[model samples]
Target chain A: MLARLRWTEFGRDPGAAIARARLISTLGPLIALLLASIFFSIRTDRFLTTENLSLITQQVAVVGVLAIGQTLIILTAGVDLSCGAVMAFGTIVMTKLAVTHGVNPFLAIALGIGVCLGFGVLNGLLVTVLRLPPFIVTLGTLNIAFALTHITSNEETIANLPDPVVFFGNTFRFAGTTITYGSVLAVALTLITWFVLTKTVGGRHVYATGNNPDAARLAGVRTRRVLLAVYATAGLLYGIAALVLVGRTGVGDPQAGQSANLDSITAVVVGGTSLFGGRGSVLGTLVGTLIVGIFRNGLQLLGVAAIYQFLITGVLVILAVAVDQLSRRRQA
Target chain B: MSAVAARVPVLEARGLVKHYGVVTALDGADFDLYPGEILALIGDNGAGKSTLIKALSGAIVPDRGEIFLNGTPVHFRNPLEARRNGIETVYQDLALAPALDIAENLFLGRELRRRDIIGIVLRVTDRPRMLREARAHIADLKINVGSMKQSVETLSGGQRQGVAVARAAAFASRVVIMDEPTAALGVRESGMVLDLIREVRARGTPVVLISHNMPQVFEIADRLHVMRLGRRVATITPASHSMTEAVALMTGAASSQGPTKG
Candidate 1:
């Protein structure tokens, strides 16, 4: 019924053109992915192999989780500079308790989650109650968290973790394929985040709060609470990702996640999520993460060094932001 | 006043006063809203219409006033409080979120949550029920909307006004107050909204419509409560006075000068 109404209203001329445009946009990324896969398959002997694909998946998993959290925060016109440091803090706290204090690994994991949730609460308090700008507040917290991680590890790496914990990190065999648990966890988080943001009341509240606080408030929506909740939830996810990071490395390093925040934010920006807020999707973020993963993997496969790949990724981020701005302007 | 055992006023205000720093916006204004009636409030710009509406809707707390709902004095801390008590104001801006679709906007503050408690929960919009109810309500008023799911941004001016009226009607239990709802609409759309106002009164919901348009006012209003400065200068029935008389009363040209903004 809706389609028929739209068809009759916007008819064959401009309507048909818009329909074509939407179809192209929906299919555009898939076409690009297929093309990239074909090009790499023809150029490189190892590109299509299970081992190489698995390596790429594991490499992007940590960054993917961070990007998902960043995407949620960014949708509310907010950013989390402390995401990386918070993850690092979680890693140190979990490892110190489990490895140094000989606490149950599961209990230590819970402790790590709790600590990260505390940081999230702090962020929420600073943003909502204190009415501080998210950028400045998170920047301060980022430095503070980074300092705490260093102090927790005593400026040294904590390694030689328990065998069971290490298994979570190193073991990747599933259905006769070499896929790590980190990769699986990343995929699960992405799906869950996507569903919540697109299909639930919690997600709609974020969009409403972002778009117009006054209207949402009039509608009986608790704007301050929703804003705080999103930031706190982001902080909690950083903690979970931190566990995966520590499990895989079999070591906890204070500096490990310091740069992950910047990379994840870049991927979110590139994934079509607006920085000014009120619009974005997890599915778009996945495609965006994939684009980054493929580009980095392809660059390395073609023997391009790390520095060049970093430079290319930086350029891609700028290009993505520019495109987003241009499209927004056109719509306006 | 021939009192035919005046039905209890749905909303009544006495000694209402508001202040912004040293400026006095409202000065002990008295108003009455009875059931099954349309009250037309008219005054010059800055004559306290905005201030009075704001106070009634809980946008501002009057410095001194006693508001009564059905003869019982009450205070609304905010607009939601007033709404929960059956007073819904359709503001000049309409208070509709432009980005949200029609259904979402209709259910904005009061979304219908499903019957569920926990784990892997499934939720779906009760679209059919909401749409059916909404359609039946509008149909009784003889208004037309192409679709309930279209964004308000895509709707024409009359359609938007219809939606706003529908929203106020859908929610309000006793009174629906419109603040210049037809001020920005085209000719035909304004007429449609006027029809809606009549239909609302017929359905027994007292409507407080604020407007300065004389013909539109005389056509729909049952009781014309003209305000000059801060006080109602005349409460003339449309059947008793011509449009010219009502305008004359509104502009303070009548023998009675009405109350000043003391």
Candidate 2:
């Protein structure tokens, strides 16, 4: 009788239904990724080669890493407009310190990372302490970081980077797959971020703060500190992305991260991570980055105009957010 | 009053005064809660019951007052401080993360870590232990939640209230202050909450229940503290007054009866 009435499993949890809905939300993007790949492969012979696939990974790695950081920020219901600018300023500082000033390569990189992290700290302070909107603070920092990059680098590209600076661009051939260490870095960072979000108490706090800051505070969470840590962590990720940028370009270009802010955000949303925050994953972000890369490569192969290519990508991002909102509304 | 009660109360607020510009939320409110007792606080609308609970829970700082935990004067600058001092509150809004599961909600601030060396090196949570313990804990409340993994957002209103009450019951060592725990609950769910309150009191933790529901106030409460305007007017037992007498006291239709001098 006790065995019959046992509540170990009430058949299936009603939550399974909600979980299924979430799975469908993520699967929509995955299917889109697969379809885009198929569409590109059939249209052109050049799109399917292992060499081209490796190149796409290379193109997306920096943005993917940035998106990983942006994913954390967005998970806390904040956006980082200065991400690309942080990377750009980072590249300038790194190259200028190592090449022009002849600082130690490692020290130069550390300084560059420090510079990027500072923007995050500043962003955190403005948002938490000053109670400023994240969008405005990051926008101001984006202009500031961009201007600093220009002024610091004399609006010029620093060339003839050291061999160690472009070390991430070093490639290894595995069968037909040409793998760059930068791609490995992106994957590693994403996995590490995934572990933090899913396994740690602090990770849970991040979700709580984003889900409802007032509730989080009442529940005894230090919300301001959580927000500060998230913004700072994102800054650190941008700094790391700057390293990848240097490796890929093999030169310190102040203009390298110009398009990254929007691109990274697009990747994050496409990955099924919600802009509303407290609902998304780093793994989904990686897929979103891949989708963007595949579309860009395919559109180029189809001889699509740069403007039209731009229009298509922008439309896809908007469409993804629209779908996300619709699904969220239904759930609510 | 028992010997321990006469010595020192579990939780006490002495002459708490709070103001919002021209309006006074709590004006010289004096409150006391003894260990292993359910002290029901009921008042008319805007009678400072919430303001008093807020001061006790560290949700708001009183303009001028002092709170004592086990007779030691405590200054709670924030809710975290109050929690550290063993004061947990279940607000009317049920401060829970909607996306997180039940186990996560139960262990939100003070999550248990793993026991082995891997736990020492890494900050990974003890998920299995948390789930097992949360299951047993919520089971103690006799709530029929489908799964420990279910997000609080997926829960019915009653289940959500159950989670909030369970969280407070599990953590609160000194006192648990609940603000209208059964406000939105149906008849059965509200009954469950009252039972939970009794169970909490049975565990020897003092409970300050703030509710507008008079029958509920009378049913579970060992003693009732009636508030009018901004001051506690009377402290009566279920046997001391009928429901109509309590209503009359609250609306000021009858003269205030001060706490009976023993």
DockQ for every model, please. Answer: 0.28, 0.47
Tens digits of lDDT, candidate 1, A1-332: 44234323432343234334334433544565677788778888888888888877877788888888888888878988999999999989988898999999888888987898899889989999999999999999999999999988998898878765555466657766688788788889999988777556667778777766677777767889989989988988888888788877878888798788888887787676767776567666777777778878887898989899889889878876776665445433
Per-residue C-alpha lDDT of model 2 across residues B1-262, encoded as one tens digit per residue: 2314456788888889999999999988888888788889988999999989988988889999888888889998878889888888998875788878899999987888888875667778899999999999898777677679887877766677878989998888898999998998778668767877888888778899999999888888888888888888887788788889888988998778644512
Q: Chain B, candidate 1: TM? A: 0.89
Clash totals for all candidate models: 1, 0
lDDT (CA) for every model shown? 0.76, 0.86
Q: What digit string (tens of lDDT, one per residue) describes model 2 on residues A1-332? A: 33223322332354556677677667978999999999999999999998899999999989988999899999898888899999999989998999999998988999998999999899999999999999999999999999999999998999888877778888888777998999999999999899988888788889888887887878878889999999999999899999998999888997788889999999999898888888888899999999998999889888898788778889989988988887666655
Which candidate number maximizes DockQ? 2
State the displacement of the C-alpha of residue A265, model 1, in Å, after optimal TM-score superposition: 2.7
Which CAPRI quality tier does the interface of model 2 achieve?
Answer: acceptable
The pairs that clash in candidate 2 are none
List per-model TM-scores for chain B. 0.89, 0.93
Position A181, candidate 1: lDDT:
82
TM-scores of all models?
0.85, 0.93
Error of 1 at A210 (Å): 2.1
